[model samples]
Target: MNAEIIGVGSELLLGQIANTNAQYLSKQLAEIGINVYYHTVVGDNATRLKETIHTAQKRADLIIFTGGLGPTKDDLTKETISAVLDKPLVTDEEALQSIESYFKKVNRVMTPNNKKQALVMSGSTILHNNYGMAPGMAIKVSGIEYLLFPGPPKELYPMFENYAKDYLLSKLEIKERIESRVLRFFGIGESQLETEIEDLLEKQSNPTIAPLAGDGEVTLRLTAKHADSKQAKKLIDDVETEILQKVGPYFYGYNQTSLPEELMKHLINEEKTIASAESLTGGLFSERLTSISGAGAVLKGSIVCYHNDVKQHTLGVLNETLNNHGAISVQCAKEMAEQIRIKCCSDIGISFTGVAGPKVQEGKEVGTVFVGIAIEGKETVVHHLQLSGSRQAIRQRSVYYGCHYLLKQLKERD
Candidate 1:
């Protein structure tokens, strides 16, 4: 079924808040093979919301409304929808009791305005709110479904997941589940990846391929719909295999997973402890690594040897090497990686040295990065990358490349 999402908030239009609920809902809808054709953002104005609903009703069968389900004056979502459908605004006694109980339990004075949250349209299925005051409702008037959910993400996400999702699913005749996978790539340009898979996109139908470019990475989302989930996954895998036949070398991880997460998993599984020596990334590589739970088993530590003096005195890089090639050189990266491994006594050492910039530095242009990896019983290997992005983007991408490189090495050894 085709769906349209309406995000009702003056705060959203004013840029005070983001419409993340639409994003979350769209993903949920897509899993059940529902197409979210349009996302409309309306302010707290009742007339505008009514117009939005009128417009959506002409095109979409499912209209999901988020926000404006609060005690405040601006919360006019349900009122407007009720007026448009000519449904009476009836008070949900259960929701009103819950709100009253909350105030009584907390020993706080209950303002009369709190009753606003308990308003629901008559002849609607009450989607109970477990998170907050506003209990959402799903109304099917004239065979067109309208779901009104709370504004706060904490309240909206859970309410939708618990009640609204099931309500929508029961209405839908979904013969298949839509499974999607994202193949993340760095080092390769989006244009290049697209050019390579141009034919696939041009003739795409089942398991469609979509390419998206961002700061310093490219992601290809592969989606397939099938009655059997395993068959759907196999279709996605087949599409991935076809794409990987040409551009597999640049592929890193899958949906919602990054190079750092994948690298940590590999490192943990291999029983290898690692450390990082940073110049440009400022220990960002280690920072990401340690952010993962149980990383203490695989990550030793890191050193931010940003200054030449720190590189010399702490990590013990030769003064001559620093004076000769500067800190951005591959030799300095190699030394930094080796020194950190020696110091941390880890099985592997990684280093990031680069000119991430808004301007040039040390006779090198911005985005010039050198990733050095020193593994036990192997010569220190350096991978130089001439990246592109702002200083922060370049630094973060350097960390990603570091993980990619480390993962590649581990895979090769295995």
Candidate 2:
């Protein structure tokens, strides 16, 4: 089914808030073989919303709406939809009870306007809102399906996942399974990755190849649809194998597996401990590593040597090295990594010393980076980089490169 996601909020048009609901819904719909043709954003005006709905109904079989479901008077999504569909707004008993129970549980006073959240379109299926007060609804009018959701992402995400997805699935006649696999890659440009798999991307049929580049990384989302689940997976695997054959060296991990997470996975699997000496990144590398669980088994500690004195006094980097090569030099980075590994008694040590943008340091231009890796019983190595961007961008990219370098070293060991 072709669908249109309508976001109802003047805040969205005024740039007060983002319409992330459309992005989430579009991805969800695609997984179910439903194509999202349009994303419409209309302010809280009933007349304009009615016009938008008319326009959507002309082109789409499904119209999903998000926002304007609150206690405020401006929250008129349901009222406008009910008017357009000629359906009366009726209070759902279960929804009303749920709203009341939520207020009671919080020991808060419920205003009269709050009851409006429990109202649903007449003859519509009630979708429970576990995260918020507003109960969403799914109603069919003139053969077009309308799905409503609350404004907050926390409310909309779970409501759609737990209730709306199953409801839509039940309405489908033939249930065709769609499988999607996202291959994450780093140290490769989107154009280069696409060129490697250009043939498959051009003549793609069963499993489609879609390349997206963002923040020094690229991802290829492969989606395959079939009646049988295993057959669909086989189709996806076949395409994946062909793509991997050409540009697999840059491939790091699968869907939703971040660089930090992938690095941690390898460290944990190999039973290796790590420590970090951060300079320009300012402990960001350590923060990324410690953010994921099971990091304790592999992470020993981190030393944020932002100041020259800290590098020399705390991590025991020689004052001679700092004065000679400077703190941003590859030599200093290598020494930092080796010293941290020795001090923390870890199997691996990583270091980040960089000149993030805005000013040149130590006669070095901005975006000059040095990432060093020191592994036990292995030669210490440093990767020199001349990057470009704002200070934050350079720092973030430095952290990503550090993770990628560590992953490469771990993979080499394996």
Candidate 3:
């Protein structure tokens, strides 16, 4: 079934708060094979909300409303929807008792206006809110379904997961399950990755392939639908295998897993320890590694050798090599990686040295990066990249590249 989510709040339009409720509802609806085509955000005004409801009713089979279910004067979602659908508002006795008991437990006198929280449309399914005072409601009018939820995430999340999900599922005539898997890739641009799997995207029907780019990474979301969950998953797997045959080398992890998380997993699983020597990135690589749980067992330490003096004195980079080729060169990176590994007595050592700048450094243009990796009993590898972006972007992308290269090395060993 097709759906539309209407968020009722002025704070969303004014940028005071995000409309996270729409995002959550869209994902939940997608899992039940419901396609959400539009998300509409309206202020607490009754006229605008009624207009939005009219528009949603014309195009969508299911309309979900969030927010404006409170005790204050501005809370008008149920009243507006009742006017549009010609449904009278009635008080749910059990819900009224729950709200009254809550105020009694808190040792506060309950006001008469608070009774409005328990008011529901005349013929609707009451979704009791376990975490808050207002109860959510679901009703059907003129072959269209309407579900209302609270604005606060703490209350809305549980209400939808426990009650609203099953209510919608029961309304579906054909019970088709939808499954989606996101394949994450670094070191490849979105356009390039799309080109590599263009054929798969074109021929997709049961399982669809969509590419999305964010934070210097590309992800392909594979969604499949079937009555059998295992069959749906197999459809996605077959498409994934076909796509990966062309671009598997760049694929790092699946669905919500990041490069740092994947790297930490490999390190801890293989009983490997790593150390980092930073120059331009200023210990960002090490910081990313240590942010993951169980990092203490896998990360030895890091040396932020920003200046040439620190590289020579602390990391023991050869003064002659710095004098001849400079710190941004491959020679300095290789030496820094090897020396940090020796100093920390780690199984692997990685180094980030580059010109992430607004100005040229040592006659080199900005975004000239050199990453080095030295593994015990393996030949040291250094990568030279001429990147383009702001200083912060360059630095962040450099850290991602470091993780990518290290993952590649670990995969090769495996």
Candidate 4:
């Protein structure tokens, strides 16, 4: 089914709040073989929303709305949609009881206006919102289906995943289901990667290949439509295998798996431990590594050797090398990685030393980065990167590259 998403809130228009609901819903709908054609953001104006609804119905088979389901005067999404569909807003007793019980449990009084949140569309499938009081609704009017969800991402995400997706899938009359896989890559530009896979994309038919570039990385989304998911998956896997045959060296992970996540998994699988020595990145590698749960299993510790003195004293870098290399060379990176591994007594050590700046440092131009990795039985390896961005962006990208470097080496040894 071709669908359009409408985000209804003045706050979204004013940039006070982001419309993350559309992103999540689009991904879910795509997985279910629905094609999202348009993303519409409308303020809480009845006339404008009605116009949007009319436009969406004209172009799409399904319309999904997020936001404006709260207990407030400005929440006009349901009011407008009900008017457009000529449907009544009836109180869902189950939702009302849940809201009332929540207020009672918290020892707070429920104002009459709060009941507005429990009012669901008449003759619609009510979506249970276990995470919040607002009930989502799905109804059809004049052959165009509407799925109304709450604005809060926490409430909207689960409601749609558990209830709305199944409801739509059951009603959708399609001969095939679309299956997609996202293959992530590092150390390869989108243009170069696309050039390598140009032939596959040129002759693509049953499965299509699309490339996206973001944050100094590349991603290829492979999508296929087939009657059997198992057969569709095989086709997708075969296509992926063919692509990998050409560019697998740059491939890092799959959908929703990032450099940090994959490194954590490998570390856990290898029963290895790691530590970080930071200079330009200033503990960003450590912070990201520790953010993953069970990271303590693989993460030993880290040292933020930002200053020359800290690098000399904490990470045991030679003063002479710093005086010559200025802490931005491959030699310095290797020493930092080796020192951190020895000091922390871990199986692996990683280091990020760079000049992330608006101006050059120590005769070294900005965006000069060196990521070092030291494994127990392998020689220390240092990878050089010349990146360009803000200081924070450079640091974040350096961290990803650091993980990518380590993962690459680990894969080589494996």
Candidate 5:
């Protein structure tokens, strides 16, 4: 069934807090084979909330409301919904008793307004809150289902898991499972990736392909629906295989995995140690690697040689090469990579050197980057790139490219 999530709070509109409830509910609904079509956020005003409910009723079979269930007068989620649905609010005896017990245990006097927390829509199934006082409720009006949940995550999460989930499952006539997988790619643009798999996207049926680009990386989320979970996964896998055939070289890891995480996994599996020499990127490459746990097992050290003098003295870059070709050249990158490997006694060494700034360096344009990869007993390779973006973007992309190249080399050995 199609669903719409409505968040009720002025804090969300004012940016005082994020609407994380919508995100969490969307994922949960998707897992149960419900498609979330839209997310609506409205303030505490009852008139606006009533208008939002009207809009949601037109397009969505299921409408879920979060927040505004509290003791204050502003807590009007149930009142607004009851008015919209022409339903009366009645007190849930169990919920009222639970709230009274909580206040007594805490040695606090219960106010008259606190009883409002026990109110539920007439003929609605009450969802007991184990973590907090306000209870949740679900009811159907004119063939559309309406669910009310508390705003706080601590209360909402358990109520949904323990009560709401099973309630929805019992109401479902057809049980279909939705499965999704995310494929991550670097060193490739979204337009190019889409072009390569244009036919698959056009003819998609069981498994739908959606591409998203962010931070110099592209990801495709493939989703499939089936009665059997394994069959749904198989449908996604078949589509993924077809897409990967065209862009396998640039494809890295899967959902929520970063380049550093994948690289660390490879290094740990291969029992290899690595070091880095940073020029334009500072210590970004090493910093990313060290952010992951067990980084000490695979990372030896790093040398930051932002200055020509440091390159010459610390990384042992030849003075003649720096004078003739400059620090941004291929010769300097190769020397930096090789020197760091020797100094750190690591199995692999990577170097990043470039001109990433508002102005050019050594007559080279901004975003002129060179990444060097030196593996033990292998020839050091340097990749020259002319990128475009802000100085920070250039530095970040340079580090990403360094990891990509290193991963490629490691895979080749395998």
Candidate 6:
């Protein structure tokens, strides 16, 4: 069914808050093969909301709304919709009891206006709110279905997932399941990756392939639909296998898993401890790694040796090497990695030294980078990269490359 999302909040228009509810609902609707044609945002004005509803009613069969379900006077989402549908708003007994129970649990007296949170359109199917006072509703008027949800993400996400999802499924005549998988890749430009997989993109039908690029990484989302879920998954797997055959070298992890997460998982699984000596990246590599839980077990420590003297004094990098090759060289990077590994007594040492700027440094151009990796009982290796971007982008991409390189090393060891 075609759907239109109407977001009701002055905060959204004023840029005080994002309309994330529409994004969430659109994704949910897509999984059920519903097309979201338009997203309309209106402030707490009844006349404008009425006009918006009239326009949506002529185009869409399903109209979903978020926000304006609170105790305040501006909470007029239900009132406006009631006026448009010519339906009466009545207090839901179960919802009223839920609201009262919430106030009793908190040992606070329930205010009179709070009862407005329990009101729903007459003859509507009530959606229970497990997270907040405002229960949602779904009703049919003149062959059009209207779904209402509370604005807060915490309240709206659970209510839609627990109640509204099942209700929508029950209304569907055809039973179909959509299975989606995201393949994450690094060390490849988006255009190059797309060129390599052009054949797959062109002929895809059962499982559709869509490529997206962001933050020095590329992701391809593959979706397949079928009556049986297992069959749908198999279709996706078949397409994924074909795509991977061409570009598996750059591919790293799956849906919702990132380069840092993959690196941490590798370290934990292999029982290896690591340390880092940072230069231009300025501890970003260590920060990203430590953001994951249980990082302390695999991360011995890190040193932000931004200066040549600090690298020599703290991480034990040879002063002669720094003097001869300068800070942004492969020799300096190699010594920094090997020395930091020895100082921290870690199984692995990784170092990042780069010239991320608008100006050249020590005869090297901007975006010149050297990443060094040293593993116990293995020969030290350094990867030289000439990247392009702003200073912040260069620093962030260096951290991503470190994780990608570490994962590649761990996989090769196996």
lDDT of each: 0.91, 0.92, 0.94, 0.91, 0.94, 0.92
- Model 1 error, position 10 (Å): 1.7
As a TM-score, model 1 comes out at 0.94
In model 6, the runs with Cα more than 4 Å from the true position are none
List TM-score per model, in order.
0.94, 0.91, 0.97, 0.90, 0.94, 0.96
Model 6, 1-414: lDDT tens digits are 789999999999999999999999988887876778999999999999999999999999999999999999999999999888888999999999999998999999999999999999999999999989888999988888899999999999999999999999988888687778999999999999999999999998889999999779999999898878899999999999998999999999899898999999989999999999999899999999889998999999999999888988878888888888899999999998999999999999999998989899999999999999999999999999989999999999988888888789889999
Which tens-of-lDDT digit does each residue in 122-237 have in candidate 2?
99999899888889999888899999999999999999999999999888877777789999999999998888888888999888888999889999999999878899999999
Better of 1 and 6 by lDDT: 6
lDDT of 4: 0.91
Q: What residue pairs are clashing in model 5?
A: none
lDDT tens digits, residue span 25-132, model 3: 988888888999999999989998888988998999999999999999999999999999999999999999999999999999999999999999998999989999
* lDDT of each residue in 89-181, candidate 5, tens digit only: 999999999999999999999999999999999999999999999999999989999999999998899899999999998888988999999
lDDT of 6 at 194: 96
**Local error of candidate 4 at 258, Å?**
1.5
C-alpha lDDT of residue 131 in model 1: 84
Question: Which parts of model 1 are misplaced by more than 4 Å?
Answer: none
Error of 4 at 404 (Å): 2.1
What TM-score would candidate 6 get against the native? 0.96
Cα deviation of 85, candidate 2, in Å: 1.7
